[model samples]
Target: MDYGPVIDFHVHLPYRYKDPIAAADYLVKKLDEANVERAVVIAIEGGVESFKKRVNPKYVRNAVQEILDYVAHSPIRSIRTLIFEPDKGIDEHVQLLIEHRRRTEEVVKAVEKYPGRLYPVGSYNPDYGVDKVIERMRVYRDKLLGVKIYPTLHCISPSSSKLYKLYRFVEGINGLVIVHTGCDPGLWELPKMCRYARPKFVAEAAKKFPDIPFIIAHMGSYSAIMPGIYFREALQAYNVDNVWMDTSAVDPLFVERAVEEVGYDKILFGSDFPYLVGFTIEDSIRDILKLDISSDAKRAILHDNAERLLRMLGRL
Candidate 1:
């Protein structure tokens, strides 16, 4: 299956303790080996510790540094998405606010350095109240691709009224929103969080913002059995043009179902790299190439749709 020039719409740069530039080079090498033309590099702001501990300034600092290094050394065209983890519970409001501001500043600086390569995305926690969320959105409006919300991580429903303001802001800017749907195995201890990670909530938002593009990450396949649930919910929005889904570390079975339900034009190929653990970039691409879909559909999933997105954002 010749996919032509492929674009991985979802990927994360290495952010542990390794040298940032070397980690980027390693990632670019992998992309080159797999014939990937480009990828959307997202900063991983929330993870295991995000739920349990207070925001670590050092961790945020390191993440920003990695974003800078990765974009600076990327071997192919790359779009950078600055990740944000807004304050949720009442425990550390002041600290969380400070951390969000500092992180946003760092991201803005990186975008300034790389210009076209880096795009910021805002995040909101209902706990932050709509006013503050809108304020931050306004601050980054010029640089943002859109906003990313993790209902699972923030313990908020996707359709919660708390998010309407942000959605409207995004719509007003003609931006995009990427939501994390499906089951996140890493959040096993946080069962309540997983409960809200359904595609239905996203459908509600889609109805409200008909013009803004909303991407459902993982095609709603967070866990092994729940892919059906996620896929079913996503199918409900098949007629809604602004709603799209990504093939990020999902079962190939659901990937095929998504195409069958919504068509390849709505599906974007993503590797979920580094975080995909044992799987190589080739493993990710192979999942799509081996699918029993049309050659044209496969090509669209691998490259066309993502390129369309980039062109919409003026990144191309």
Candidate 2:
């Protein structure tokens, strides 16, 4: 029951609030409610805007999802339904990037409001154009703890050449990188895209950016349709140093296995808050607290590891 010095490392700005100030306010309120001391908020453009259009009844989106979530965790939990969306045209991709750029700006603004309590991380994608990526991200060049890249949502390889320049930019800024690794539900579930989220691809990047820490978000174990589907890949990636893994939406069972095998030095605690629907930051925190691992590991995952990384980067 004792989770020492908690730091939720993987939260996103509240989609419900378009305003950065309101989003940060809601974030702090939720953090306080969950008893989390600090949180790292990634400004990734989420699927709420796009997914709502696909919902049969837009108003019932959350209501229906809450029920589906209940079912996903029950006795017959293994059953999952996938929503495979086809290729998005160039225009749509540009729009998504534009929105993402806007969110990055908001995150910079939000972090300015709470320096120590809230850490800022921005997002980038190829469609945003290599030039635009750096331009938009420069808004936080000196302020960011790191950048969060989504391979599945953006449909690019973890080690794509398009991202090399971005990596170099992050390196220049002395910031870390967190890459999306695992299957996301809704429009992002296309098998082609899911394949890109595998952590094996990120190993290539880790090798390329030996000086920069690369945290594989979800540790390649995040699958809304198949929980822990890529856990082996995550375990494999954990072997190399300077490449960390986060337990954002990963099952505790996998975390238990990870600790038993790899130890906890490079693991981080992240709550894919607000985006995971039907789940809360407190629930995400409890996932680690409920782990059977020793208190030392729990402290390391919940706080120490992230604290060390942030302090090492001079973000905390």
Candidate 3:
């Protein structure tokens, strides 16, 4: 099962704790035991707490900084993503983007501290008007490697034309997108907003934005029977060309199906992480490795796909 050069394209670093490094240490141990080579750790604003209405942007920033500091000395490569709630509409949207820009500036000033291991990903609420957000992205295109969207929580369909420009912006910047898929966890604010969990919606986006690299998170909502249906359509529609799926927050059976149907080159390994602290990220990778997919396919899923993606975006 020696999956060399494995990479995790999805993971959330727990920041709400008193010590974020403690959490990173736990993750490093897991990665070592599981033989993971590189892991992308996205910053989470809140851990097991209400993040919708009561989230403090300052708190979110501090928590992320703590996690970054912790990962600085670790063996894992931690890619930092600035997270925000897009449902806040215009004013909050402007404020969040401004803050994100500032945070990115700070990271840039401090890049030498973390070196090549750290990179930034931007995000916005598509429902508010993807065009408006792309306007913001135009300002900081150089600092961002890609953007992340949670269509379900934003109550927006990925197929909206408003997002067309946003997708174009990503392509123009040579960036990728990570999307949340499937049913929302029972969080109060999340479930209310997470209506677009269906993979078909994302598939349509992938179809439309053929040049935009999209990663469907949580294996299309971990529907045992659904990914087969959704991915089949995705493959037929996009030939699995620009679309990708991640192992984050998904069931093992769905991962197997994604590899089988979409081919391993389109699947990125991820762990929702921190939210499920002490979670076996490697266990998920191991599950995918056990699948009957060829070693090359396994290699693609574990490492090659992500490497190509990072290369495409000039992040690697």
CA lDDT of every candidate: 0.65, 0.75, 0.57
Badly placed stretches (over 4 Å) of model 3 are: 17-35, 43-115, 126-132, 135-139, 187-193, 223-240
lDDT of 1 by residue, 1-316 (tens): 5557788877655544244345455666777888987766554334334454533444333433544543334332211221233222222433333332323334444335444443455555445556776786687777766777777656677788878888888877778888888765322212333667777788788888788888888877776423454667767755677788888988899888777866787889988877788998888898889999998998899989988987876667
Q: After superposition, how far is residue 150 of candidate 3 from its true place, in Å?
A: 0.7
**Clash pairs, model 3 backbone:** 152-194
TM-score of each: 0.73, 0.82, 0.66
Candidate 3: residue 92 Cα off by (Å): 20
* Candidate order, lDDT descending: 2, 1, 3
On residues 1-316, what C-alpha lDDT tens digit does candidate 2 reach at each position? 6555589889988767778899889989999989889998887754333333432332233323444554344343112222111223223433544554436777889878887898888877444656787888886688888788787666567688888898999998889989888877543433444678888888888988898899989877776556776789888987777889999878789889999999999999999887778999988888788889998898899989999998888775
lDDT of 1 at 79: 17
How many clashes would you count in candidate 2?
0
Model 1, runs deviating above 4 Å:
17-29, 47-120, 125-130, 188-191, 224-229
Pick by lDDT: 2 or 3, better one: 2
Pairs with steric clashes in candidate 1: 183-222
Name model 2 segments beyond 4 Å from true: 46-102
